[model samples]
Target: MFIGRQHELIALQRMYDSKRFEMMVIYGRRRVGKTALIDHFLDGKTALYFTARQQNSRLILQSFAMAIAAYFNQPEVDFRSWDNAIDYLVSQARRHAGDKLVIVLDEFPYAAEAEPSLPSILQIAIDHGLKDTNTMLILSGSNQGFMESKVLGVHSPLYGRRTGQIKLQPFDCFDAARFVEHCTAEDAVRYYATFGGTPYYLAQLDPQLSYEQNVAMLCFDQAGLLYEEPMMMLREELKSPAIYDSILQAVSNGCNTPKIIADHIGLEPTSVSFYLKTLEELRLIERSIPFGEKPTSRKSRIHIKDPFFAYWYRFVAPNVTLIETGSGVEIARKTAESAVFATYVGQQFETMCMQWIFRAFRSGKLPLMPVLTGKWWGNNPLKREETDIDVVAAEPDEKKILLGECKWRNTVNETEMIASLRDRIGLIRGYRETTLAFFTKNPVHETTLAKYRNDPDMIFVCADDMFRER
Candidate 1:
């Protein structure tokens, strides 16, 4: 089940091989495989691993002392204070069996929660003695905000003390597709969109079952594993789950602007922004801007970056009462026939296309390379309506751009689609020459495709291209 995270494992390995003191801050949202990554990295190494829980500080200290006692083959050692325990660790490191004594404090925020001065104690130990010693320290947690503000921020005692950090992101569509086997391209995409790239969620999927059956089993039923996971995660991180729930619901329901989300939640825009920022810091939501827009642009929009959260709020949460009453199978069948589900999958497909295009562009398959790739939308004067562009790549310094539209459906005509693309591209006046591209599940009409086939500045990707990596 340990599928991805080769890059993070390599980073941690280098720190271990450095034979010097190293502090790495690893944090992300829950179920994102933080512990799994650490476990994978520390395999075959006799490192001292300690996991902190939500107990009293005295109990935590007792538990850590027991682990240390087991590690050092001592008979039930005890500690007078946390400082004493850390000094024993430093002493062990000075005479450790290996060149480096790896020490991982997993769920570090929980320890700090139980003991308010835990970070300060660690900081004092590092500053006074273990600065260049071979005690490689890895503090890992799932609380993104707490780890950032209390451990990495400038005002914290541990600030500017870490040698490296890894904000472990979920796998992309390509890596996510690897979890599904013996499925069609469409079914593979369906599984990926439903569970996203989180290894835990994807592992819960049954490859033998149909997509609808799996949805009924995993989401449409009250006993489903994922049915309670979102709420549990929010409660674990946020103090007010009711407010955060409303915010997630509003954003997933298509409320992108801050004022729009505020209006939907019946809160002031300021409060809405504050909650959204908290969600963003937790890596639960993301704010997006146009490809080449300035970083300070106010036109940014909020969206649920996690695909599982999006599917839950959009489909599962609203029908929970119906599901609990034992009509979940019928509801899931109805969901399969609904156009809304298709549209949701279409949006996920758009993200896949944009990502695939970026990779292809970087590998010299495209005519021009781009430094920035994002979604772009703006006013349309010719059609007297708003224009939306699914994928836009910009090389601002080179004055080049690539415009693309992604379609998940089977029917796409070339002439009509290209004409529409022309009108939408005409609305934006920036690059000297903008190439048109299409990424669809099906191929385009050949007559119209032939026109662009000879054009040097065109790129085309279909479903086969997206799934070929598997």
Candidate 2:
């Protein structure tokens, strides 16, 4: 069943309502629901959809001709060339001058790769006829690099042609919860942490099963759909899956810097940087600098951006041999009960808290709306050690700041947690007002809640609060 993407639907509807020629570019990683969103939006509309495949140009053209013929309710039609096919499409759009006809070229890169001149042909068609017709032309692809460089880049033939673009992203924690509505809030969080927000991955989860059961089946079982999903994706997107796997494994094991990752993988730092850039382009990993630092800060760190990939590399990749030997169930059980897994969940929980803070700020639920929000890590001079804040936000003038600590444990020492957070307030200088937020997996102690009940600067957020729909 379809889930979120309400904003995307609204945007597409707005474009459709315009009743004018529109060129929309939709692109994202595979399984991120770009196709699902497009299908949903075109549910009752008169549209021609053709998904290109990796094949010869002649076969792709034949398939495109078939789709067009079907759209036009013809017995059969053959287009001799890309120019003829595009010209025919424009002619159909011109026939329906006042009606919006959506022509979607899904997996456009596949077709473009098969026929290198397809983009220039479409560019000429758009310039000569399609742009003035009543066609809402949409080009969608899963190859972000191809879509960006070949279709959306400044030097591309189709440059300055698209009226709108949507770089579809994965669902956030809340939208992801919809797939496992029967699961408890905590269990839902765990499921999200494990499977991540990819709709395809989440749909593979059966809500009837517990989080551990789901993980065991989906991740541990050799026959499961996601058992080798990370490897498959890497092989699909990269030239050297083995090298990428090592880099991902290193980053997942806490080797965050280029030099450290290179050392762990036994590669030169310069060589690793090229592979990292490719992964970044594919949206598998990200490079991040601590909040309040410049973009070029040396403190920058690399992280696996997808939770499922991170979880796989950390928990499954290391135990692949055991899993293949039919000992996966035991390992899954131990993983669920291990402190290491809890630590991993806690790290994901911090990210959820950051998402919650951003949503709250946008919805005007925050005490002070800050201009910037992110994780902060640096040296704590007073303590003569390094420290990190789970979440940090600052106002435009840097006079107001919000500091947060996320605790995924069942029980927290409220007094100590508060004191630790309070002590770190000095890390950010020149803050006139400081708001402290404590995010926990479970509710805090009764007395702790009562003590901070009336404290304006103290904000307490639990898992339920984070899951609650605002």
Residue-pair clashes per prediction, in order, are 0, 0
| Error of model 1, residue 195, in angstroms | 1.5
lDDT of each: 0.84, 0.90
Task: Identify the leading candidate in terms of TM-score.
Answer: 2
Error of 2 at 92 (Å): 1.2
TM-score of each: 0.95, 0.97
> How does candidate 1 fare on TM-score?
0.95
Write model 1 residue lDDT over 162-235, tens digit each, in one string: 99999988888777877876687788777777888888888888878889999899889888888888898889
Against the hidden true structure, what lDDT does model 1 obtain? 0.84
The alpha-carbon root-mean-square deviation between model 1 and the true structure, to one decimal in Å, is: 2.0
Model 2, global lDDT = 0.90
